[model samples]
Target chain A: MKTWIEKQKALIDFTLASLARRKIKNLGLLLVYTLIVFLLASVMLFTHALRKEAGKVLENSPEVIVQRLVAGRHDLIPPGYLEKIGRIRGVQKKEGRLWGYYYDGVLKANYTFMVPQPDALMAVESGKIAVGATMARMRGLVPGNTISFRSYSGKLFSFEVSSVLPNKSELVSADLVLLSEADFRAFFELPPGYYNDIVLSVANPLEVRNIATKLSTLLPDSRPILREEVLRTYESIFNWREGIVLVLLSGAILAFAIFAWEKASGLSAEEKREIGILKAIGWETGDVIKMKFWEGALVSLAAFLLGYIAAYLHVFRFSSWLFEPVLKGWAVLYPRFELTPEVDGFQVATLFLFTVFPYAVATIVPIWRAAITDPDAVMRG
Target chain B: MIEVSEVRKAFNQGRHNEYWALKGISLTIEAKKVTALCGPSGSGKTTLLTIIGCLARPTSGRVRLKERDISGLPERFLTDIRRSTFGFVFQQFNLIKGLSALDNVMLPAYPLGGDWRALRARAESLLDSLGLAHRREARVEWLSGGEQQRVAIARALVNDPEVLIADEPTANLDTALSKEFLAILEALAEQGRTVLLTSHDPLVVEAAVIDSVIDMRDGQIVGIR
Candidate 1:
């Protein structure tokens, strides 16, 4: 057993040394394979991290919300609707919320405005608002800075920055400005008695449905939204964006796969004959397989590490601009996100199994065929 | 130690096409003896040598090495036998192109796996004994044909295989180098090692100094002289 182990080690060492001698050819293959693995690892890591980050943002949101819907549109609810909902049996607390979308013509960007509360879970200082970290960085805005924008009615408004929000929500958290209820109404030029939605806190979170039923009887035009529904919407948008990325990157994947297959299958007759010679001289089929396995593994590992590091810097530090247009459907200034390098062992393992394993398996059929070919026929060449 | 019984090998070119490279031929090679198989070109000498070396299997009949039927062994086991017990020197001097002479000598023993120091020492001793110490570090391509032949011989002998099989070992060498190459084989045989050599040169036959000579033609043994 000791001798056998030694023999295997020798074979591996010899194979690696031989590869080093032919560095140009082998390293070229390694680079290509590594790039593919890197892309795969980066996508997996970023997507998985996005879910956790988005979840953190949603954790602080209301358990249930009631929005007025009319003819499939979310219409504004009357301010007096909050008073009626607050009196419901399961309601713990209820508040009318004001929010609207505004466009910055100069920056070609959109921002969201939401009513802030002094003691609310997501409150900010009066006349001053919190912005998404990414939005603040891109717009070059900071605390005490003022950003001006135009509402849908073409009315101009401005707000002073109080603080910047953490970039925990990657895809779901819109670039936002948080103001007091009065400030939101004034900025959007809305009447004193209107709101976009009514956010509710419940004594029993699970009683949201019962509260919604009660509110339906009191205000039939309004629909209740469970927290899960909002989360599903967020997931759907991300999934759609992920599908687009998959489609756009499919060509690169196919090109790399073809490059790998061509390299494996297009060995010259001389190379085929060399394999025959090695087999004839006493190399086991298993040994040949192992040699090729190492070749694939070494290449993919290097590519994965380099590509992953590049993607980490590109996405987290540089705000994932490379994928922004494809993901967002337009060029939008992404806020800076400090992504802690999260090494997911399961994800790394999966990427290895997915990217490297198949390429290694694909290589075997061709190499095995070449190795087992009749030595006489090989020698004849 | 080597026996062939009515061995026949046939290759199919394609549909409805068949060619017999070797016919039913029987020969026995004695233990610890040097035997030379001599024949003209296209006379099946190389095919018979390959069969004896366990590099190829005869399509019919059987080959026995020390009473063990090797023809029935799987390709992988046959290869193991070749590496552990049989050494081959081909006519083309099949040294891996980019490797140095020392590395070439060490190639056969690589699978055996010893301490690096011991392996290197063994390879160095072989090169020195073969009078190739000066060219030990030279790449196979940079070596002369004679030097390359010496390296090939060193590779074959490095594993201390039980049988040394040389197919046209000196076919590409000058008369002087060929004579020098045969002297090394003579010394190996003197150490009680079995050496099976194939050659077409009359000068090689004269310089054999072996215990037996087998002449082959048309895949059959024509004479055992």
Candidate 2:
């Protein structure tokens, strides 16, 4: 056992020296290989981070949202639907939500306006507002700055920026403006007893679907969106987008794979001679295969580490700007946020198994085929 | 000592291009002596050397090393026997190009599964004896043909095998370097190691140290002198 380990170590040492001897060609292959890994890993890490971020915010979301539908389109929910939903079993808490999209013609961007709850982090007075970090950045508004937006009825309303949400909440609160209920209603021209939706929390989490079904039967026009369903929808959306991008990027990966396969499978005349010489000098077929295995392993492992680390830094530090449009959302105004750095061992292992294993296999076949040939024949050539 | 009996090798068997590289031939290689297989190109000198060297298996018949039949053995067993019993030198001086001479010398020891330090020591000793101690760190690609040949010889001897098989060992060397290489082979043979070599050059085949010369024609032994 000790000798086997020593032999492997010696072989690996020889492989490293061999790689260094062809430093230029090997390094070029390493750089390109690393780039491929980086791109794929960045997409994976960015999507994972987005899902995790969405999950964190979703943990605080209401268990169910009841929205009134008119002619299959979302309409304002009457305040009376709250009473009907409150009577359902397992109902814990119910709140009327007042929110609407506010488009600023001046900035040519859309901002989401919502009524602030009494216990909200930011207190908004009638003539003042609290904006999200991204919103403040885009509008160039700081605390105490007056920003004006024309309401849906053409009434211009101006409010002092009271505060900006912190960066930690940027994903959820980006492009959000919080104001008093009266101000929000007036700005959106919503009548009394009408709200965007009714958010409900259930005392028994497992009975949320049952309560939703009861609400649907009681109020046929109301649509109840379960929190679980919302989460699954978000999960599928990100996964679908990732799949599409991966499919598109598969062409590039395939091209590189072909290049790598050709590079690995087609031994140069010098390399063939080297193998022949090694075999001639009392090295077995197994020994030659083992050496080639080390060669393949060293190249792939190095590429994986370099590519994965670069992807981590790219996604976590730079917020995956390269893939933000495809991953974060297809919107003109994207949320300015950074992904949390967290390593998924399974994903990393899967990537290694998928990326490096195939290359190793591809490399071994050619080496094995060559190794089994008559060394005398190869040496003569 | 090595013995070959009724050995035959056919290439591309049963096909239109089927050709026999070696016919039923027999020979005995004595220990502690230098023997030469002399023939021109297409005369099967190299093929017979390769068969005796265990680099290629004979199509039929048996080869014995000290009375052990190695002809019908599996490839793995044949490989083990080859590793422990024989070392080889090729006509082209097939040294791995990117590696230093020392590295090439140490290549065979890598698979023997021993401490690298011990392997390095053995390789150094061999290189020292070959008068290549100063050029140990030089890559074979930058070495002269004679230097490369020395490296190849050192690599073949590093394992300390019982038999050393050289296929056209002096093919790429000048007359002077060829004499130097033959002198090394003679010294190795004097040290009680069996030395078997192939050469068409009269300078090598007619060396004073050679104990016998086996001449071949058409893959069969034509004469022994």
Candidate 3:
């Protein structure tokens, strides 16, 4: 076993030297290989981070939300519905939430406006508002700066920025604004006993789904969204987007496959001579194949590690501008947030099996064929 | 001792383009002596050398090295025999080009699965004996033809094999280097290692220390001296 390990080390050393000898060609392949892995990994990591961030915020979300539907469209729920929901068997607490989207003509972007809870981090005064850090940056608004926007009622409402939300909450609150209830109701022209939706908590976690079903039965036109369903929806959306990007990236992947195949199948004249010489010098067919295996494995493993680390930095640290347009294409105001750093063993294994395994296998037939032939025939050629 | 009897090799067998490279050639190579095979091009001298070296299989007949018939063995067993018992020097000095001289010499022993330190030491000693110690770290491509030939010889001796086979080993060298290579082979034979070589060079065939000269024509042994 010690001897076998030493031989492997020697083989690895020889492979590194051989690869370095053809630095220009091999470096070019490494760069292109790294880029392919980077693009695919960035897409995967970004979507994963988005889903994870959404899931984190969902932990704080109400177990169920009841929204009124009229004529197949969402409408304001009557505050009376909250009282009825609070009376349900599993209902622990129920609150009426007032929120709507306000489109700023000046910035040409939409910001979510909501009434702040009493125990919220930022308690707004009657006419003041607290905005998110990204919102503040987009509008050049700081604390004590006043901004104005026209509501759905065609009335202009102005409020002073109290404080911007911290960067840690940027994923969820990037476009959120919080104001007092009086100002929120007046700005949206929402009357008393009405809310955009009603959020309800259940005393028992398992009974939450049961409460949702009961609520749907009681209010025929009401839609009760479960937290799990929301998470599943988030996952599917990202998966769909990832599938589309993969389709677009297939061209590059195909190009790499062709490159690998060409290199493996052609077996350069120099390579043939080397194999012939090795066999001529009393090296067995297994030994020659083992050396070639090390060569392929070294190249594949180096490319994998370099590509993965580079993709990690690109997605989480550098924000992956290369793939930003494709992933966040539809959003005019892209979220300025860092993706959480995550390393998924399964994904790394998948990348290895996908990228390295085939390239390694591509070499076996060619190497074996060279090994099995008479050394004189190959050297003479 | 190595014995060959009625060996024949045909390429493109069972086809219209079939050509026989060797036909019914039988000879014996004595241990601890220098023997030479002299023939013109296409005389099948190299083919016979390869069969005896276990580098190729014969279509018929037997090759017995120490009374073991190896002509019909499977490839894996043949490979093991080749690794443990035979060292080969080719006409083109087929040293793996990118590796240094020491590395090339050490290539044959990698499959032996021993302490690499011992292997390196053995390779180093062989290179030192061949006056190539100073050139140990130089790549084969950077070395001259004579230096490359010496490196190939060192590689052939690294495994301490019982038999050494050379096919036109002096084909690429000038007269001076060819004579030097012959002297090295004579010394190796003096050390009790059997040496068999094929050469077209008269200087190589007429060397004073050769035990016998075998001449071939049309893939058949024409004379033995």
Candidate 4:
């Protein structure tokens, strides 16, 4: 076993030297290979991190959101709607949520206006408000600054910025403005006992689905959306976007594979002579194959590491600047938050299978052909 | 001693380019002596040398080492015999370019890996003996033809095999280098090594150190001296 290890080390050393000899050609190949890996890895890392961030944003959300439907369209819950949901089993608490989208003509962006939940981190005074970090940045608001916007009812209201929402939850709260219930109802001219939706908090996770089903059955015109379903939708959306980007880059992947295949299969005259010399010196067919294997492995592993590190930095550090537009979808005021640095082992394994393993296999048959040829014939040629 | 009996080798058998390089060749080489196969191009001397070296297989007949037939052995066994029992020097030297002389000399022993320090010592000692101690670290391409030839010889001897097979060892050498190569072989032979070589060089055939010379034409032996 020691001898075998020594032999492999010797081969790796020789392979490195050999690769360095043709530095120009090999480096060009490496550049292209790294680019391919970087492209694929960036998409995977970005989407995965986005999924994780979305899950984190929804972590404390109500277990079920019941939206009333009228004429097959989402409509505001009318009076007595909360009473109608009075006694659902497994529901710890049920509350009405008031929220709506406000189109700010000045910024040409839509902001979500909502009354703060009871457990919100910051409480708003009757005439004050708390805007998200992104919203504050766009409007250049500080704690003492006041901003005014015209409501749909042709009424103007000014509110002081109590605090900027935390950056940690920026993905979901980027365009949020939390105001007191009096300010909200006055701005929207909403009458008493009406809400955009009803949120139910269930202590038992298994009971969330049961309560949702009961809500849907009891209130025929209501839609009970579970947190799991929301999470699944988020996952599918990211996956779909990732798939689209990958499909768009399929040509590049194919070209790189062909390039890898071509480079591996085409042994130059000098290379052939080198193998002939090795065999003539009593190096066995297995030994030659082993050397070639080391060569491919070193190249593949280097490219993989370099590419993955680059992609990780691109996604988590630089915000994946190259692919942000396509992956983030169309939005006027998008979040610029850092994805938590994390690596999925299964993803890395899958990437290895797609990139390194195939290239290693590609080199075997060609090297074996050269190895098995008699040294006499090769020298004579 | 090495023995060859009725060995025949054909390339691309039954094809349009079919050609036999050796035919019914039978010869015996005594241990601890220098023997030469003298023939013109296409005379099959190199072909017969390869068959004996275990580098190529014979289409028919048998080659025996120490009276043990190796004709039907598996490739792995044949490779083992080649590494342990035979070393080869080609006409072109065949030293891998871009490697130092010491590295080229150390190439043969890499497969039978054991005590690399000892192997490096042996290779260095061989180069030192051949008056190349200063050139050991120089790349093979930078070395002169005679220096390259010595490096190839060092590589062939690195494993300390019993028989040394040279296919036209002097084909690419000047007269002085060729004579120097012959003297090296004679010294190796005196050290109880069998020197098997193929060449058409008159100086090699007439060398005083050579014990016997076999002449061949059209893939058949024509004379023995």
Q: lDDT: which candidate is best?
A: 4
Tens digits of per-residue lDDT, candidate 2, A240-335, equal 999988998899988887887777677877777778777777778899999989998899899999999999999999888787777774344578
lDDT sort, best first: 4, 2, 3, 1
For model 4, residues B1-225, the per-residue Cα lDDT tens digits are 888999898999999999988888998999888899998999999888888888788999999989999987877888899889988888888888888999888888888767778888999999998889999999999999999989988888999999988888888899999989988977897798888899899999999988999999989989999
Q: How would the candidate models be sorted by DockQ, starting from the highest? A: 2, 4, 3, 1
Error of 1 at B73 (Å): 3.3
- The residue ranges of model 4 lying beyond 4 angstroms of the native Cα positions read none
Model 3: residue A156 alpha-carbon error in angstroms: 2.6
Lowest summed lDDT across 10 adjacent residues in model 3 chain A is found at: A325-334
Model 3 chain A, TM-score vs. native: 0.94
- Candidate 2 recovers what fraction of true contacts? 0.80
Residue pairs in candidate 2 whose N, alpha carbon or C atoms collide under 3 angstroms: none
Error of 1 at A171 (Å): 6.5
TM-score of predicted model 4? Answer: 0.96
lDDT of 3 by residue, A233-328 (tens): 877877888888889988987887788666655677788888888887777788888988887777767778888888889888987777776664
Give the per-residue lDDT of model 3 (tens digit) for B80-159.
Answer: 88878888887888888778999899888887777788989999999898899999999999999999989988898888
> What are the per-residue Cα lDDT tens digits for candidate 4 across A182-237?
89999999998999999988989988778888888899999999999989998898
Worst 10 residues of 2 chain A by lDDT: A325-334
Quote the lDDT for B147 in model 1.
88
Comparison by DockQ, 3 against 4, better one: 4
Q: What lDDT score goes with residue B142 in model 2?
A: 93
Q: State the DockQ of every prediction.
A: 0.52, 0.73, 0.61, 0.65
- Return the TM-score for each candidate structure: 0.91, 0.95, 0.96, 0.96
